[model samples]
Target: MGIQINGKGLLIVLSGPSGAGKGTVCSALRQQAPELVYSVSATTRPPREGEVEGISYFFKTRKEFRRMIDQGELLEWARYVDNYYGTPRRFVEERLNEGKDVLLEIEVQGAKQVKECFPEAVFIFLLPPSMDELHARIKGRGTESEQVMTDRMQAAREELNQIHSYDYVVVNDEVARACHHIRSILVAEHHRRDRIFKEQPDWLEGI
Candidate 1:
């Protein structure tokens, strides 16, 4: 029989420029790997239509969010478009301790903050097939004004500069393919020698 292994869960951070389909890929990943925990973020923004508190986000007031920051309750946080968004520390820790892989879908800026706090997390950067494709996707949204779109494109350009800091780069050409790549990455990480040794099976004690 093959050696039995007990492995700690992986902390995965997924980030990409706007319109790169991070949400679509993540949704596919959830369907493919139902056991993985999706980390819900806390935000100061008002809820949109059909959004439920603690399900869509832990909606907090600006004062409460500021308090969380002061108390260091957040793993990472960033302000975008005059609203605060952040990941809570306790839920992630609890899930990881239960040996459940946790996925954090965040912005590049927030990902950098998370890197500082949890360097061991498997950071994945999603990329569009090309700049033209990215631009097209952003334009296709039909929800933003030309000025807002222009600003988003500019932000995307800046976010691209931080790609080197991530552990892996996955091009989101198709949702299923990208989710497959993420699943493969998790499997490979679980098989890493260091992680395997850290599990320290009794069989290895005398070898």
Candidate 2:
């Protein structure tokens, strides 16, 4: 029989440039691994149509969000488009303690902050096939002005330069392929030497 990893849960944080298909891959991954608990972020922005609180996001007011940050209640936070977005620390830690692997989808800036709090967490960078393809994908959305698209491309370029900081880089050429790679990473990490061999097994004591 194969030995199983112990009860400790993993922290999986996924980040990448805009239009790199992070959301699409994550959606497929959640479907593939429904046991992976999702870490809902807290945002000061008003909930959009059909978005539910707690599940979609823990909607908070700007004052309350800043208070959470000041009180050291958030794992990572960032101001984007004049709104504050942050990860709640207590919920994630509680889930982890309960042996639930938590998944976090964060922006590049906020992700950098998460690294400070969870250096051992699995940080995966999703890269697009090419800059041209990335730009084309962003444009295809048809939701942004030309200037906004240019700004997003520039930000994406800056984010790409920091891929070296991540533990693994998954090129999102195809959604299915990308999800496969990410799942493989999760499985492999669980069997890593440090994770699986934290203490000597009694079976090998006399060998």
TM-score of 1: 0.89
Candidate 2 residue 182 C-alpha distance from true site, Å? 0.2
Query: Which regions in candidate 1 have their CA more than 4 angstroms from the true location?
Result: 1-4, 46-49, 201-203
Top model number, lDDT: 1
Clash number for model 1? 0
Residue 78 local lDDT, model 2:
86
- Candidate 2 residue-wise lDDT at 150: 95
What is the Cα-based lDDT of residue 53 in candidate 1?
A: 88
Q: List residue ranges in candidate 2 displaced over 4 A.
A: 1-4, 199-207
Cα lDDT tens digits for candidate 1, 1-207: 345454678899999999999999988888888999999999999999999987899999999999999998999999889999899998798888788899999988889888998998999999999999999998998888999999999999999999999999999988888898999999998888777776665547656
Residue 108: error of model 2 in Å?
Answer: 1.5
True-structure lDDT of candidate 2: 0.89
Pairs clashing in candidate 1?
none
